[model samples]
Target: MSQDSLDDAYANATYIPGAAEYPPRWTKEARAFRDNLRENDQIIEDFPYGEGAREVFDLMMPETPAMGLAVFVHGGYWLRFDKSVWSHLAAGLLARGWAVAMPSYDLCPSVRIRDITRQITLAVTEAAAHVAGPILLAGHSAGGHLVARMACENVLPTNIANRLKHVMPISPLSDLRPLMQTAMNDDFNMDEAAAMAESPIFKKPLSVPVTVWVGEDERPAFLDQAMWLAEAWECGHVVEQGKHHFDVIDGLTDPDSLLTQMLIGGDIA
Candidate 1:
């Protein structure tokens, strides 16, 4: 495909005018909620998994005894965002008594995408150490790709992998090769080999089942991505109607949302 066509396919943010404004809102809400939690001593803030400035995590302890561990990884296309902006997204999981941990990894351009996979693997393992029982991974966009990568990267041991109940990658980029043609690739510096190495689509079959979700109104490529990964991994998928790329992930912050329910392994009935 021509470079223009390819870039258009990946231009998710462009589809949503004023998408730039979302981050500020996330920052404001996340900071306020985190402060409330801190005032009540309800959170473990800036807990480190690595030495880098971005390698820390924020743990939001559920009010009740935690049933399982749930890690929410943020999405900035492997380049932006930190755990702090996503603290508020823990509400749904927290309400279910699931201990929620959000980890920040070194961004691309600073570190290759492969390095991010390692950092996230370390973060998840570290978070899991502090909580007991099976763990569920729910990530958005790039975060979705990361959680999916964690599932098949040979990073988790059978013991830990066995305890994994679900792997959900919401609006994830399962195939990274196409990204090489997009402007996002400018910061990402993805060559053919690196894309092959990083795309979850090329990874071995997962250690656990994966559930994919994408906004029904998202770009065609995104919908294809969800279906492609599901087919590649032999998993299932849901096209969230009336949702776009950014808002599609709003479900993670709502405990009653289907996305949250999927992670908790419970049914609406």
Candidate 2:
């Protein structure tokens, strides 16, 4: 396909209704959530995971002892958003007694996607030191791609890898090859070699459990991307009915939501 078509295929906000409102709504909700947690002294803000300016994470603790740690990474095609806008997403797992860590990594054009992956590795390593038990990962869009990378062999330290219980990549870009065809590649600066090297679909995953989740209402390209990762890794796949790329992650806010249950592992009923 032509570059224009490829770019159109990957364009998410353009296809979603009222897409402009979602980010502002997310910011408002996230601020309220973080402020409330701060009031109770339950949230730790801007904890540095790495030396870079954006290499910080926010840890939100539960009322009771935490069962484990769940780290969430936000997505803007690896170029936008940060840990702050996703603070509220921790509500579900927090209610279920799991501590949640949201980390912000340097964006593309500023740093390569591989660089962001390494930053997340450091973030997870640092966050894991603070919380005990298993570690569950959930990331949206480009963030999905990063968490999926963590599931690959040698990407994370053995100690951290061993503690992983589940990885749920929500609407992830598992294969980076296609992104090269999109205009976003200008900022990504990914050649064929770099794209293949960074793609989760091309790498063999470690022995941890993985579930690829996507919205049924997402573009065909995203649907195929989700399926490719599931088939390549031979893992579970969930295409949430009626969800679009922008709203599929709403399930993370509800403790009883299937997405949360799958990630944190609890009684489904």
lDDT of 1: 0.87
Against the reference, the lDDT scores of all candidates come to 0.87, 0.95
TM-score of each: 0.96, 0.99
- For candidate 2, write residues 217-242 as lDDT tens digits: 99999999999999999999999999
Please give the range of 10 consecutive residues that has the lowest summed lDDT in model 1. Answer: 153-162
Q: Show model 2 residue runs off by greater than 4 Å.
A: none
Candidate 1 residue runs with Cα over 4 Å from true position: none
How well is each residue in 83-107 modelled by candidate 1, as lDDT tens digits? Answer: 8787888888998889999998999
